[model samples]
Target: MDLYRSGDHYVLHADLPGVDPGSVEVSVEGGILTVKAQRSERTEHDVQWLASERFAGGYMRQLSLGDGIDSEHIAATYQNGVLTVTLPVVEKAKPRRIEITPGASEERKIIEPADAPEQANKT
Candidate 1:
């Protein structure tokens, strides 16, 4: 399994040659993603004894997602014996530009009411 980030999403690729696409299962729970696949063994009774080096059995893989990941929008695709999974970044976790406004400094004068009495003594 190989994982890398591409644009706003993280991509995961796995090689599963000679495996049926229908037998593969993917699930996510508690911020963890799991992949399971089954490769059936060949059943030949009249064949001569030969050396076998290929793997034929149940395959599984799991990954723990971080807080920045958007688990609700994950997507997976299988093509040409390769499985690709896309995990998008959360909206709040993505980088954004904040606009800043310049501050204005001004002075104001206070006016007294005509009915108010003025001070008679200046000390």
Candidate 2:
């Protein structure tokens, strides 16, 4: 499995050759993302196999997502035996530049209480 950040989303790629796309399942719960796939075994009684090295069973993987990720908008796609999952970052979590405006005046004003004697003397 390979994971990387792309723009405002995180992309995950997993290799699942010889596996049916219909048998793949993805779910997220409690900030944990789980991926499951099943590869059926070949049942051939009339033919003899010379060698069998490919995996034929269940495949599962899990990942813990951070608070910045928007789990509700996650997407997954399978193509050419490769599965790609996209995790988008929340709008509030994204970084942005803040604009600063110039003030109208640089003068400072101080308000004094009516009963204050020291403030009256300064004025």
Candidate 3:
């Protein structure tokens, strides 16, 4: 599993080969992203091979995400045996312009609001 930070996004890539894409499941709960993959075993009957070497096992990976992640906008894709998961970054607690005049700065105290109220306002 690989974790990377992009502009306004967090990307997670898990290398899962020999696993069926349909059987793969990805979910994020309690700020933790979990991935489960089920790989079916191959059977060889009445045939003897000189050399046979292949990997077969169930793959499971989990990641504890950092702060600021929009879990609702997360997306996952599986192609070419690689699973690509993307989680949009939640707006960070940064200083935003409050649109105050030069004189107002002396009298006004900028108060940083909590993230919960912002989310409530959106709804």
Candidate 4:
């Protein structure tokens, strides 16, 4: 499985060759993401097999999703024997520039010490 960030969201890719697409299940419970699938090989009666080295059975994987992840918007898809999961980050977690408002210094007020009455009156 390969997981990496792409733009505003993170993507996870897993290879599941020969696995039935209908058997693939993606779910998020609490803060964990889980992937489940099954692979079944063809069988024939009264046949001899030269070699068989393919995995066939129930397969499952789980990932812990920390804070800032928008779990509600998370989505998954299976295509070409590959499973892709998209994890979107919340707006507060993304980096953004804060716009500075101008004219703050223009509204400054001059203050003089109480003991310096001459300077206060001059201003």
Candidate 5:
């Protein structure tokens, strides 16, 4: 499984060849995302084929997700034997704006609190 991010969206791409869309199941539970694909056996008959690179089997892969992902809002798409899962991250997880306040120009002061104990005084 390949993981990536674009803006507020996180993407997961899995390569599942010869697997039907119905057989593929994707879900996120307890902050962990899993992709499972089950393939059915195809009875082969005596036939001549020039070349075949595809294998005949099922595939399953799981990935541990972080807390930034939105577990409820997840979408998946299967195209050309590639399963692409898209998950939107939480609003707080995305980059946020930090309000900058302008202050009056004054001389810089480096002074500790009077009541606070000094570090040098400690053993």
Candidate 6:
């Protein structure tokens, strides 16, 4: 599985060849993200098995997601033997640019607090 951050959300990709799309499951609980999948093997008794090397069983993976993740909006999709999961970060977790207004750095520019007038009267 490969995971990477794209913009405000994180994308996860896992390969599950020959696995049924309906068998894939994804859930998040208590800040933990879990993914489960299953692939069934051929159980025909009449066929003679020559060689069977492919994996066939349940697949489960759990990841400890931090508090920043928005678990309520988590989404997943399976297509062409690939499972894709998207985890979006909360609004507070997203990066915000702090605007640096033209402060008192220049003599022509003056920065005053909202309570500046009240403080002056008290002085």
lDDT (0 to 1) per candidate: 0.89, 0.94, 0.82, 0.92, 0.84, 0.91
- Which 10 successive residues of model 3 have the least lDDT summed? 92-101
Residue pairs whose backbone atoms clash in candidate 3: none
Model 3 lDDT tens row, 1-123: 888987778788888888888999999999889899988777878988888677677777878776777889899999998899998877773235778558744776555677768878899
TM-score of each: 0.76, 0.76, 0.70, 0.76, 0.71, 0.76
Which digits, one per residue and each the tens of the lDDT, describe model 5 over residues 26-105? 98888788888976666677978777666767677778878888888999999998999999999889988999976788
Worst 10 residues of 4 by lDDT: 104-113
lDDT of 6 at 9: 96
Cα RMSD to the true fold for all candidates: 9.8, 7.9, 15.6, 6.7, 8.5, 9.5
Query: How well does candidate 4 score on lDDT at residue 42?
Result: 75
Query: Which candidate do you rate higher for TM-score, 1 or 3?
Result: 1
With candidate 4 superimposed using the best TM-score fit, by how many Å does residue 102's alpha carbon deviate from the native? 13
**Clashing residue pairs, backbone N/CA/C < 3 A, model 1:** none
Q: What are the per-residue Cα lDDT tens digits for candidate 4 across 19-98?
A: 99999999999999999999986777798989878898989999999987899999999999999999999888898999
| Weakest lDDT window of 10 consecutive positions for candidate 6 | 102-111
Model 2 lDDT on a 0 to 1 scale = 0.94
Compose the digit string of candidate 1's lDDT tens values, residues 1-123.
999998899999999988899999888999889999999898878888689777899999999997999988999999998999999999898889999865576566565765344533332
Model 6 misplaced stretches (Cα beyond 4 Å): 99-123
Lowest lDDT block of 10, candidate 2: 106-115
lDDT of 4 at 86: 96
Candidate 6 lDDT score at position 53: 96
Off by over 4 Å in 1: 98-123
